[model samples]
Target chain A: AQSVTQLDSQVPVFEEAPVELRCNYSSSVSVYLFWYVQYPNQGLQLLLKYLSGSTLVKGINGFEAEFNKSQTSFHLRKPSVHISDTAEYFCAVSPRAGAGTALIFGKGTTLSVSS
Target chain B: DTGVTQSPTHLIKTRGQQVTLRCSPISGHKSVSWYQQVLGQGPQFIFQYYEKEERGRGNFPDRFSARQFPNYSSELNVNALLLGDSALYLCASGPGNKDTEAFFGQGTRLTVV
Candidate 1:
């Protein structure tokens, strides 16, 4: 079984300032990591995913994440944030294979980017 | 192409009432999964269907059920709804059995009163 933990519940930043959302996971087997963004009253949209290869993954809206195997973490970062970036971000994980392997999500981090 | 689509953007039901939510997967996608998201929390898996068969089920009770049609559309039926059942029901679809990124619908907000 795999589980995800998002360290921060909320993060506040000024417009054009950088921000980071921390995420960690525990799994006995290989897993897939994903980041999703949810706007107010909207569904989750996949921001990015890390399957293999490059440890540094870039995503939409100028966001990026680095997968650190030694640290067992996948932290999302944005060089500069905008007010529109204010939303809820979630980190999710799923086992590599087998039956009933659904994505387990973290509690989520609320990003508040203000001007 | 249209993304995953769910019907009845909002619904209200009394306790013990039954409710059915619908979903239409993206074109060419064969997998559909259901999730329940209570306020201020991440979504919890409910069920997953592939090729018209049940592929997986989450920690939900038997009162929660779902099925996929030949066209890859799906329905989630919750029997004897309770106040705790009030949540946003999300539908996601992927192309295959592999862990590909899934597209989600806006979700149906079910309010059990």
Candidate 2:
């Protein structure tokens, strides 16, 4: 079984400020990582994913995450953020070998941006 | 193109009653998955179906049952519902390929009283 932990339950930042949402996972084998964003009353949208290869994986909306194998972390970051970026962020992990496996998600981190 | 769509955006049911939720996957998608999202918590996997066959299920009880149709539509039925079952039911559709991305629907909010 695999689980994901999001260190921050909520993050508040001013517009144009940089932000980092921390995530960690515990797995015995290789895993695929994903970051999903959920706006108010909406379904989740994929922000980025880390399947393999380069440590730094960039995603849509200027978001990026670095897969740190040693630390077991896949933290999401953005150099500068807009108010539109305010939403709930979830971290998820799926087993690499387990085909048809369901993604395990973290509780989530609420990102609130104020102008 | 249409994304995943779940019907009955909001539903209210009494304890011990039964409820059924529906989902229509995107065109060409072959895999449909169901999840429950309790307030203040992330969604939990419930079941997955591919090609109209059960493929995977999470640590849920038998009271939660689901089936997929040949057209890739799906229905999730909950028998003997409990108040604890109150949550948002989400449906997701994927290409059923290892490399394709999975898309989610807005979800059906179920309130059990």
Candidate 3:
């Protein structure tokens, strides 16, 4: 089984300030990692995913995340923030193979960007 | 390309009532998954269907059930709704493979009173 943990419940930052949302996971087997964003009254949009190759993966909206195998972590980061970036971020993991095909998500972190 | 789409953007149902949510997967996608996101919490997996067959299920009870049609559209049914069942119901789709990622829909907001 695979499980994800997002370290923060909420993060508040000013526009143009950098922000990082931490995530960790526990899994006995190799897994695929992903980050998703949910805007008000909208569905979840894919931020990025770490399936293989590069440890650092970039996504839309200038967001990125790094997969650390040893640490079992996949943390999301953005060099600067905007008010439009305010949304909820979720960290998720799914097994690399076999029958466990569902994505396991963390409790999520609410990012609030202020001007 | 059209993305995953769900029906009835918002709905309100009384306690003990039943509700059915719908979803249409993207073109050529063969898998559909259901998730429930409550206020201030992350989404919880409910079920996953691939090629009109049940492939995966989450921790949700029997009250939560889903089915996929030959066209790859799906419906989620919840029986005897409770206040706690009020949440945003999300539908996702992807190619039925081990390495592919799922695409999500706009979601249906279900409020149980």
Q: How would you encode candidate 1's per-residue C-alpha lDDT over B1-113 as one tens digit per residue?
A: 99999999999999999999999999999999999999999999999888888888899999999999999999999999999999999999988754456889999999999
TM-score of chain B of 1: 0.97
Question: For residues A1-115, could you state the per-residue lDDT of candidate 3 as single tens digits?
Answer: 8889999999999999999999999999999999999999999999999999999999999999999999999999999999999999999998887863888899999999999
lDDT of 2 at A3: 90
Chain B TM-score, candidates in order: 0.97, 0.96, 0.96
**Cα lDDT of model 3 by residue, B58-100, tens digit:** 9999999999999999999999999999999999999874325
Ranking by TM-score: 1, 2, 3
**Model 2, span A1-115: residue lDDT tens:** 8999999999999999999999999998789999999998888899999887999999999999999999999999999999999999999998888657688899999999999
lDDT of 1 by residue, A10-113 (tens): 99999999999999999999888999999999999999999999999999999999999998999999999999999999999987778644878998999999
Ten-residue stretch with the least lDDT total in model 1 chain A: A94-103
- lDDT for model 2, please: 0.92
Off-target runs (Cα >4 Å) in candidate 3 are: none
Listed in order, each prediction's TM-score against the native is 0.98, 0.97, 0.97
At residue A39, candidate 3 shows an lDDT of 95
Q: List native contact recovery per candidate, as a fraction of 1.
A: 0.61, 0.54, 0.61
Tens-digit lDDT track of model 2 for B1-113: 98899999999999999999999999999999898999989999999888888878899999999998889999999999999999999988999733237899999999999
lDDT on C-alpha atoms for all candidate structures: 0.93, 0.92, 0.93
